[model samples]
Target: MSETNPSDAPSPSDPSSPDAAFAQAAELQRTGAYPEAADAFRRLARETLTLNVATNLGACLIETAEFDEAEHWLLTAARHRPTEPVLRRLLGNLYVEMGQMERAEVEYRTGLAFRPQDAGCELALAGLLLSLGRYAEGWPLQEARAGLNPGVVPPVEVSFPEWQGEPLDGRSILVWYEQGLGDQIQMCRFAQELKARGAAHVALGCRPVLADLLATAPGVDEIVPAPRGETVRIRDYDVWSRYFSLPARLGTTLQTLPTAPYLSARPDRRARWSGASGVGIAWRASPTGFNARNKNVPDDLARRLLDLGATSLHPEDTGVADFADTAAIIERLDLVISIDTSVAHLAGAMGKPCWTLLPRLHCDWRWLRERTDSPWYPSMRLYRQTEVGDWTRVIDEVARDLQARSAA
Candidate 1:
């Protein structure tokens, strides 16, 4: 999310005016200086508690993770402008940061009530519901993701009509990719479900890196490798839909989800790691992109996993070219332990034992809340932080479990 600009802030014609100070604070926020922005906004709020000042102050506080202060300012703003959906959205985000999912859901719902077309709030509420395993409600709302900003939801240009719940018998459907590699891995299992519903041809359009790996997934008749910056023209498909949307289209609920192994490693690649054994570990998500900082296990804490005789599965350390290579390495390992990344999804998709470590803050919805096992991947176990930014306890618990399993 980009910094909030104070559209109502007065013109900065006078250098000494509160308007100028507000402008300065907004500039600081735009430049990623949260502490300074919060301070400036605080001073401005003391002088005059306008809706603009309160909302901007609340936004800055949220960025700085001063949740208590953020809640006060955001609530003040929301109370003043009860019909303003943006204020409710901001309050919802602040509650999410504070790990108050129930409160967050209330804020999101209130925002939606005020403005049903608020796509951001819809997506946020969808995530919260899905995380709580309320698939029936979540999946439908998740379609709002396509209405988000182009940067968040990449543009998909296709001529085919989106496949709603229409009968798939003797019909062809293209499942085009969206989101990160981990998301693609998680959602690709739906291809087999489509086949079960009698889709005559199930074609998957995916990133080139995953094409080889996902090709092995059952019920996929074709793999269309989506090259970066190049338009992929798929022909002879009766209908098309975003890959993630399939779960909703298929009427998936927690109990009805297909949880079987749907992917496999190539025999040639598996042979490359034939002698490999013991645990495989990945402690970091991709360093680039949104939420990378929150998803990573600290280097110091990660070393503890290495000390337990696990080998690093990072591409830099393993020299893996793509997911296919990673899947092969996982096939040879007895178990995999990873942060919330593609590796965990890959292991789970291949029906390998995997332990996934989840952060308390901004944890992905797929992991759900306080769950020890994943319904999406039956062989997967989840280890989550009891408190924010505290991996020491999580690592300690994993270490003890590893030792006990070794002794057994």
Candidate 2:
């Protein structure tokens, strides 16, 4: 790690000094000014090639999708410091973006070989294995993600012991939600599994926005509202486990997927928004947090769907306060068409017909590769891009399907 004085301005005439230039670039990157940081880092790399400069510059280039430059700099830096796991991890990420999974695996494994405890490399490898549908190899590796500060998910801390799929006839377990809303929704189904295993009581913690909606989910005896980005208030639980980890601990496979429609929306809430069984659409996803890429459909896709007689049932239009509000509207819609967002998960949880449009690159591991359907959500259908950024093809196919449904 490096430190720089925020007030120290580099001299204008000779600003490319390693310390000053690196400091400036580091400051820009720290402040989330990525484009400026990329430019500064490029200049620094041109002047002098230090591992820090090269690696940091490579990271910025990757963020900006300047892959060629990123690869050059990252490879150069890795060559310079062959033992450096961080550089290899960065290179692995670059390969993932380029859809070269094998190369990415080699880089990640090589990185781990050099630094066996590198959580980032381990997590990268875990995700790669999961994406390839190697659940047995991937899930145990996923435990490496705990206590990591790399911003993928929030930290989970508990004083109680972790329950690893053991029977709990007279015990209690706390199931804390992890990651985004969709992740919470998708994994909450396991809370029911825990209850079915004879737990005395199951306390489910979730994002406050989803607590109300998820209250109706089976086996959630208690709903604790864990506000987004805030540590959950854990109380009176004998043992705990991350909700997402339940599958691996339970030795679950595609064939062992739980029954569908384990969640239900409030009937009174749904009645307020009841209308004709029109199609629901949600195009743009919230741009906040780590999922800012690879999932969002173009903003105009909703309008395009509307042109073909699809009605706007997006919760955002109804002054929707939370997932509860969103769930209410989804309950009445005949079908939901969305990008890879929480809405898709909600629709799937409720056993509604949902068609999710997936990006060509970095589609979620749960969706698997080249699949038209989801194993986790039986009612959900997947429409994938034929090429990168090719939403038009996905939308066209969806439109054709919609027309056929109408005709029938």
Candidate 3:
């Protein structure tokens, strides 16, 4: 897994050839060195085309969030090695990154059937199921990260309780938040459930922007911003559990979930947002990595919706153009029409009506075998793509629906 610098790619015209270059790229990718990996692969691809080169190039491209080119390499690799489980697994990972879970599941399941206990395959399968809201199926698969979660997360930097298992009647504990905002909102439902089981104070770990807005969310007693590596007072609290880990700790499935509106808005924002059938919109996430490819709708699509005579508020990066720094966006709008990202969660937590757009393949946990509506957030509606890259139709449908709503 030792990574070589991209600048270290063997010269294409060098007599030694593309195999060395590809091997070098693959090593770079393994070492978590992406930039170098990408340069190495690009060199190999220009001189000759091969399944090995294409697959590695595709993987590097995915790391760069260059889906257009990555898809081409992955598809080419798939064609060259149709029966290879490893190659197929790589495709599944790409699919998962692109928010295409159904296709990812197919690849993961196919690979799992051959190499049943493969940890990588299992984790991917679990994550795919979890993201889809397929709680029942995903929990077991997703547990592969049981030991690794702590390693990957930037440490809490404080000595505090790590909450796990059934509620200790009437004990206060910090319910730690992690991952993206979408995860925090989805997991907020667990806060109330924890309270019902004997948790009295749920001090939420949250970003400053979300603190006040989510204070009224169900199951929370307070909200605090976390400082990197800084520890805070536990003050009568017994433990902390990761937000997403709540479901697993609680033995929950979609059927047993507290599938109700568990989050509420700042009462002040609520009054201001009310209008003729209020709604919200968020069309982008931090535009880097897998999120960029999956979450952002085309800007023209966003502009088009504005043109359609919808009273659409620019739901992100309000001061500047395009969706960014969501708190400001949430403060202004009544409802949100957005792709599946943190903004959707923020609006949902505010108890705002949201229409969430989903790619056809979708994220792994969004599940291939499933429902259009999200059980995690009752106020949110799901609109999915019928085919890949066909966002226009979905956008049109949403625009038409919103336009109709505006008229009514």
lDDT of each: 0.83, 0.77, 0.64
Per-residue lDDT of candidate 1, residues 1-408 (tens digit) = 213333322111123345778778878776657789889989988887667778878887776678899889878777778777778778887887787888899999998998996887898889889988899999999999987756545676767788998899999999888888888999899888999899999999889999999999999999999877777777868898887788889999999988999989998788776777899999988865446666789999999989989999998999888899988899888999999999999999999999999987678888887789999899999999887678999999999999998999
Q: Candidates 1 and 2: which is better by TM-score?
A: 1
For residues 1-408, could you state the per-residue lDDT of candidate 3 as single tens digits? 122211111121222344676666677776657668878877877887655667777777766667778888778776655656665667787777676768888998887787776666777777777666677777756655545455333345446667668556978777765665566666776778788788878888865545665676777788777554565554545777667667777888867867566555445544444443445455666653234565568878877776765344444323322112344445466567878776677666555678888865434354333466666667778888776567899888998888788788
Model 1: lDDT of residue 312 = 97
What is the Cα root-mean-square deviation between model 3 and the actual structure?
6.7
lDDT of 1 at 244: 75
lDDT assessment of candidate 3: 0.64
CA lDDT of 108 in candidate 2?
95
Return the candidate ranking by lDDT, descending.
1, 2, 3
- Predicted model with the maximum TM-score: 1
Considering TM-score, where higher is better, how would the candidates rank from best to worst?
1, 2, 3
- CA RMSD for every model? 4.1, 4.8, 6.7
Candidate 2 on 239-301: residue-level lDDT in tens? 888877788887776777795797877876776666536788878777764444656767686
**What does candidate 2 score on TM?**
0.86
Off by over 4 Å in 3: 1-54, 58-88, 94-119, 131-134, 140-152, 157-161, 227-236, 268-280, 311-335, 361-364, 367-370
